[model samples]
Target: MSIQLNHTIVAARDKETSAKFLSGVLGVPVGPRFGPFVPVEMSNGVTLDFIDTGGEPITAQHYAFLVSENEFDAIFGRIREAGMAYYADPHHAQPQQINHRDGGRGVYFDDPNGHNLEILTRPYGSGPP
Candidate 1:
């Protein structure tokens, strides 16, 4: 059996605001609310569940997205137009810009929840210089 990721629970001070922020960045719609959760679904059928924490301290999480070259260009363009800082590597080896590592491009940024979000046009070994 193939082991696939299920879903991740993101802590949010306000579910609606967090969901809206993510929806704007990911270019997806925030679905209906259920209990304390507001979910955003990706094109791949994965769901990101935003849970209201009511002022509780929530640790930051990192999320990575594997996208196509065209998608990366569009998303990175949006990120730049929004003045968001982005990077190529997870360790943040490079800063304030995009990286064409293994033949593809990648960028990283933070979400409203302080989650490290990344967009990569290719896999790890596929990055370019």
Candidate 2:
């Protein structure tokens, strides 16, 4: 009886590549396409539907995921293994490092579409911000 986010469209250069890239990094599966969308379903049941920019300029956006400590470890490992540049802060002032903000570990990285992606073990402001 409450409103929930069912899905969101993510602009990308190549939908399939972006969707698969996110899936691989998050250790999730890319769902079957519905029309032009290539979806990546999260554990919370919300889906990130990736779509092409259609010859338009793709504006980069930020997307963050909350994960368990173990999940963070796995995801962070994949990020490093992929040789992706990661930062401790959203502004990317700290490279190859993670922030211990709000008493939790967090890292930021960029996707194929230049979307700033973040993974954290704790929600922001859950502790001292």
TM-score of each: 0.86, 0.97
Across 8-122, the per-residue lDDT of candidate 1 in tens digits comes to 7888888889888878876779988877789998888788899988888879888888888777777777788888877766777788878777787778898877888988877
Off by more than 4 A, model 2? none
The positional error of residue 66 in candidate 2, measured at the CA in angstroms, is: 0.3
* Tens-digit lDDT string for candidate 2 (83-124): 999999999999999999999999999999889999999999
Best by lDDT: 2
lDDT of 2: 0.95
Q: What is the C-alpha lDDT of each candidate?
A: 0.81, 0.95
